[model samples]
Target: MQFTDEDLGAWVARQRWYAGKSHVPRFRILDVQPAPGATRYLLMDDAGAVPALYNVPLALVDAPSEGDAVVSRTADGYLIDAARHAAFAVGMLAEMGVDVGRVTGSRVLSGEQSNTSIVFEEDGHPTIILKLFRTLHHGENPDVTVQRALSDAGSPYVPRFLGSLDAEWPDSGRESGVARGTLGFAQDFLPGVKDGWAVALDAAGERRDFTDAARDLGTALAGVHAALGASLGTVDAGPEQVASTGLTWRRRLATAAAEVPAVADRLSAIDAVYQAALERPWPQLQRIHGDLHLGQVLAVQDGGWRVVDFEGEPLRPMPERAIPDLPPRD
Candidate 1:
């Protein structure tokens, strides 16, 4: 059943991704496409000054609400706020087509900073993770797009690609005034792995011997870069191109200097580093993790790291994020 605009409005406000909590946002459903029992919505949310689209996937839950809310401590538990829970219980579930007759318990995974993810398990068997995308964008999400590309290319580091759900409308007369289409995704549950950031920070904080781990990471990243380069196409590295690396750093420094008053001195220092990086020359340009930080990787227990979340830096515009010509993350 298609959810009403009232339902969509109430649901989005409570979600962690709804950046505009101060006021009620308006929605415009652009399109709708339905599957066997589920539907995908393309939504336009006007929350204050920011307006964008999101992909939301949901399934119904039955039985009793016997489980405690899943909470994440990484972002200080901000993602699991009350509004988010309400949306999950009502808006999200309302769109799902699953007929879960019995829900034994619900466990929310802690530590995720971006999406409000809930792990639903029944009869002691691990099920799927409901990923509520916090930030919305147009076009295909890189996480989903890249994962499909990698899976098609037979990459092993990524988790198995499970079916996803999105929102869409049949015509202009849909009750949901907002183009409520594909809002979220569902992916296979990857168990027993620590996010790379927590692991790296743990190692850094403890001053433990992490050279081997770092080398392993370096190799894995290199492989991914190589794969991406081959899959797409690699550009030849030139001395001039390498020298321009400092430009990006300079731009970052300028941006930091404008907004952070206390960081003026630090920005100056960073400027010097940029100058140095400029003088050193540029590395070969190839497709790689545009946003490669510790947080982007997951360390599985089976002796390897799994690269997830292909979505680039949120600060960049959507077009720039998809620009195939950009350099890799520093």
Candidate 2:
């Protein structure tokens, strides 16, 4: 089945994860590849001032009534979101080397912005979650790289990294099939777990003692950090790196001031603080999770905490996200 850029642009604008949601997109197809039981598209768009790339996986069916996952109907076939297609979900697990006896049910998990997650359950096999990255990068995704490294280091603070799927394409200025991008990530899903944010909020609402849980979470974070540092060595920030970091802070503040005029009043004060911080010795930089919050963690049944989502800040560039940076800026 074939689809046009116009069709994709309109559908992408309505998606919550599209960066250029407020404006109409002008898309250019970069590459098309065959996935397990679906088709994958790499699209570039100049929707805003800058150009962006995205990955769209589609499942084609002869008729709309064939599946409940239909996304749109075209002259060629009925386009369905691959994440919502049962056959595609099972095939994705197999591509990741999961030995699930058989997929009994599959559904797309909601409340996500940048990617689509599908949950697969079987009678005897462990439940699996597949995260399909929406935005496309030229190289390995940090979410997959970091998690795999941590899992390999025997860290108990992360879910088991089963495997991942990637595709190669011919990008401009590169040799044929030189550019590779991550398609999806597979991991073990822990059932009966509660998000740390929800647990904390519930505890606060009930006025329950959460000190023990907080301490355990801190330990888990420290353990993950240790594992990452061991796997990917740390580097001492040189003077030049420190200066660059300070410049980034100023640039961010300037952008914020331009977007929200109210920030103008405190601009000077913020700059003063940044200048003072520059005078102090910089801390050693390592590949720590760039964005860590209560919501990025889960509390398991045994009173243990597990960190998830190593994608970093959604606004940061892919290169920066993969490198060693300062600890999450609270």
All models, RMSD in angstroms? 7.9, 2.3
Best by lDDT: 2
Model 2: per-residue lDDT, tens digit, 180-217? Answer: 87878998888889999999999999999999999999
Off by over 4 Å in 2: 65-67, 124-126, 173-178, 260-263, 328-330
Model 1, 184-274: lDDT tens digits are 5555567788888888889889998788887887777766766676666666556655555456557777888789887776876777766
Q: Give residue 142's error in model 2 in angstroms.
A: 0.5
TM-score to true structure, per model: 0.66, 0.91
lDDT of 2: 0.83
Error of 1 at 171 (Å): 12
Q: Quick one: best TM-score, which candidate?
A: 2
**lDDT score of model 1?**
0.58
The lDDT for every candidate, in the order shown, is 0.58, 0.83
